[model samples]
Target chain A: MKELLNLFLTFARIGALTFGGGYAMLPILQRELVDQRKWVTEEELMDYFAIGQTTPGVIAVNTATFIGQKRKGTLGGAIATLGVVFPSIVIISIVAMFINNFADSVILQNAFAGIRVSVYVLILNAVLKLWKSAIVDKIGIIIFIAIFSLSIFTNLSPILFIVGAGLAGFIAKRQQGVVS
Target chain B: MIYLRLFYEFLQTGLFAVGGGLATLPFLYDISDRTGWFSYGQLADMIAISESTPGAIGVNMATYSGNMVAGIPGGIIATLGLITPSIVIIVIVAHFLNKFKTNEGVQGVFYGLRPASTALIAAAGFSVVLIDLVDFDLFRQTGSFIQLMNWRALFLAIVLYILANHIRATKQLHPVIFIAFAALVGIIFNFGLN
Candidate 1:
């Protein structure tokens, strides 16, 4: 029960603080979950992001659910998922009541402009860290380039890239008999 | 009732919007067309608000859109509706992955997936930086390469980047702290006024 509450509060903090949605949650999650709590490793979090992206529904919610379920079970998963969105429900409801004011607030606009740049830096650093770990080998680099290109140059969903890369890795590794 | 409709509508969206928060946009567009819940302009406005606020963009949109339709209860119902699918799907997927976690084939799959996921995020990072640092709207208007930079944001970004990555003391600071500092800087400089 205590663990569940911790999960809830931790995720609620994550949901509340991250401004730009799913991808932006990465750096924060790395800090809170990996660096602070030791709930998951950076690698496990990457795994969750991959799975979260491929699965249906919002990636941020899926990640919360994944981490929670890893810790406790269905109920833990439910609680964590709830925690992540709880802030959204409350904050959005409040903001909705005065939607016009928020929409027109120049102060909020200026703040967001800065927030956006900071978030970009955060995501860029996270991506750089991920690159060092994820793109280690020749084949890994090849897959990275292919998927990166596909992500940019095509209108296809990332789910396709994930599935294809998984299959390619499976077949490629099997042929090499490299059980890494 | 409207509550049931909100739940049902977002449930469908939660199920089918398979990638992430942004993926929900087309479905929201469809909702506007079918249910007349909000207009395209309103949807755009909702997105702007969603982007500018905290929380997942999808949840914010549902809350804002539902509130527009039916007030506070509407926000709750719509949000609950949106997240329902994530809980169900992730729990099932997590269960299987836990069981297969040690399997070699699964390990191999993740090996490739790690890089793929990194690439996906890097792509997102590129798009984000592009959006934040470039004034494409202004570029299109004047068709002048030299005038394309959002100079204030770019300067802020460079300063923040160096502090975040280069300065050892600052690098160890919490990201939220940096974000807070950035927000402060943004307000002082009126970041978007230019």
Candidate 2:
């Protein structure tokens, strides 16, 4: 029960603090989950991130689910996911009630203009950090370039790219194992 | 009935909006087109609010849109629909796939997935830059390169990027500080001023 509460509180803090989205949550997740709690290693966190991206639903929720399930069980997963989304539920519900008044404010508009620019930078930083760990081999580089191009230029679903790359890697690994 | 529809729609979104939170944008746009529960303009507002506020953008968006449709209960139901798939899948994986953690095939899949995820994120970052800094539609209509870019936004982005990356003090500061600073500058400069 204590562990469940801890999971809820920890992820609640994470959910509350994250501003930009899933990618921007990386640093905070690292600080709280990896560094402080040692619940998961950096590599495991990265794996969760990768899995979260490929899976259906929001990456943050998916990740919270993964971590929580790893920690306790199904119930833990539900609590953590609930914790992470609780803030959004409360905040957005309030915003929805008074959206008209808030959306039209000039001060808020200008603030968002600036905030949007910073969000791009935050995402860029995340991409760079992930790139360092992700692109380690020739195959990795090829997959990166292929998916990057497809994502930028086409309307193709990212799910297809992820699945295809996974299959390609599986095949390539199998071949290497056979030869060596 | 409205709540049930909300649940079903959001469940579909949760099942298919792969990649990340932003990937749900297309689905939301579709929902707007089909249901008219919210207008495109309202969807834009939801995106802005979702991006700026704490928590996942997807979750915020679902909550906002659902509330618009059927009040607070609708929001709760929609969010629950969205996360149900994740919880179910992760539980199955956690319980049954523990042994596969170090399996060769699984490792290979992860190896490939890591880079692919990175690429997708980089592409997402690129589009954010395009949307925030460049106005291609404006340029196409006006046929002026200078008119295409929001120079002030670009300048602020560059400056903030440098500060966040290079300066020791600013680098160490929480990202919320930068976001707040940008907001203050935007207000003072009257950015986005028509």
Candidate 3:
């Protein structure tokens, strides 16, 4: 029970404070979960992040669920997911009420102009970090380049690119006799 | 009828925007372009405000767009629509993650997703730069090489970019600090919307 409460409060705090969404949340998760709580090792957290990125959900929520399941099973996963989402639910509710004012506010407008640049920088750093982790082989690098070109140059939607890449991976695994 | 369309559109956005909130930008842009529900300029403003404030960028933008389209209910419905998949997926995965931890097909799908996710992020980053930083119309209308520039924003962006990269004690510098700094500059310079 204590562990479950702790999981909720900790994730709630993370959800509340974190801005700029999932990528920004990564280092914080490292500091809190890895450094302070010692809940998961750095290597494990990295693996979780890699999986978190590839999977079809929010990274923070996914991480919370992974950690929660690790700590206390399915119930814990539910609690942790709640904790992560609680902040957004509350914050967005309040913002929704006064959002028009927020949109017109001078201070916010200026702040955003600066923030826009930082967002780019943060994402660039995240890409570099993920690249170091994900692109381990010649084939991976080639796939990265091909996907990047397909996304940037052509008018193709990313979903097609993802499906095509998955087919490629499946084919490669079959050819290499790795999956069987 | 309209509400259903709105819900379905957002549902598609929620399911497929794999790289997170920013990846939803292009889809929203396309929606705006197709339906004429919102303008490109409004989308740009949404990006600006969404990036500046707190919470998930995708959710924030959805709320704003929804509010614009259908008031408070629209905002609520859209947000719910966007996050529903994440919630459902997390819950189901939590239930059975252990049995599937090392499955080869799962691993392959994840591996395939990595490059594609990167592509989505890169594409999002590119579109934002195109919309926010480059003022293509200034060149068309002014026909003057000098007036064709968004000099203030460009300068601010460059300076912020450099400072963000080089400042070694960066982790200690909260995002609010930079946000506040930018606000101060904008206030002093009166960097009003053009």
Order candidates by DockQ, high to low. 2, 1, 3
- For B1-194, candidate 1 gives per-residue lDDT tens digits of 99999999988878766557765765675577678988754664566567767898888888888888899899889888998999998888887876665676866776777788777767756754665577789999999987698887788889989999899989877566667777788889898587
Clashing pairs in 2: none
Best prediction by DockQ = 2
Native contacts recovered by candidate 3, as a share?
0.36
Query: Scoring each candidate complex against the real one, what DockQ results?
Result: 0.46, 0.53, 0.36
Which lDDT tens digits does candidate 3 get at residues A1-180? 999999999988877767866777888888999999999999888876755555665666667777877788777877876787666656655665675677778766665565565555555655666677666677677788887777667776666777787777766656666535
lDDT of each: 0.80, 0.81, 0.69
Q: Native-vs-model 2 lDDT?
A: 0.81
Better of 1 and 2 by DockQ: 2
Residue A76 local lDDT, model 2:
90
Candidate order by lDDT, highest to lowest?
Answer: 2, 1, 3
Q: TM-scores, in order shown?
A: 0.65, 0.76, 0.76
lDDT of 1 by residue, A7-94 (tens): 9999999999888669889999999999999999999999999778766688899999999999999999999999999999988887
The superposed Cα distance between candidate 1 and the true structure at residue B52, in angstroms, equals 11
Could you give candidate 2's per-residue lDDT for residues B101-187 as a string of tens digits? 667887777777778767876775675567657888989999999989999988998999999999887897766687778889889
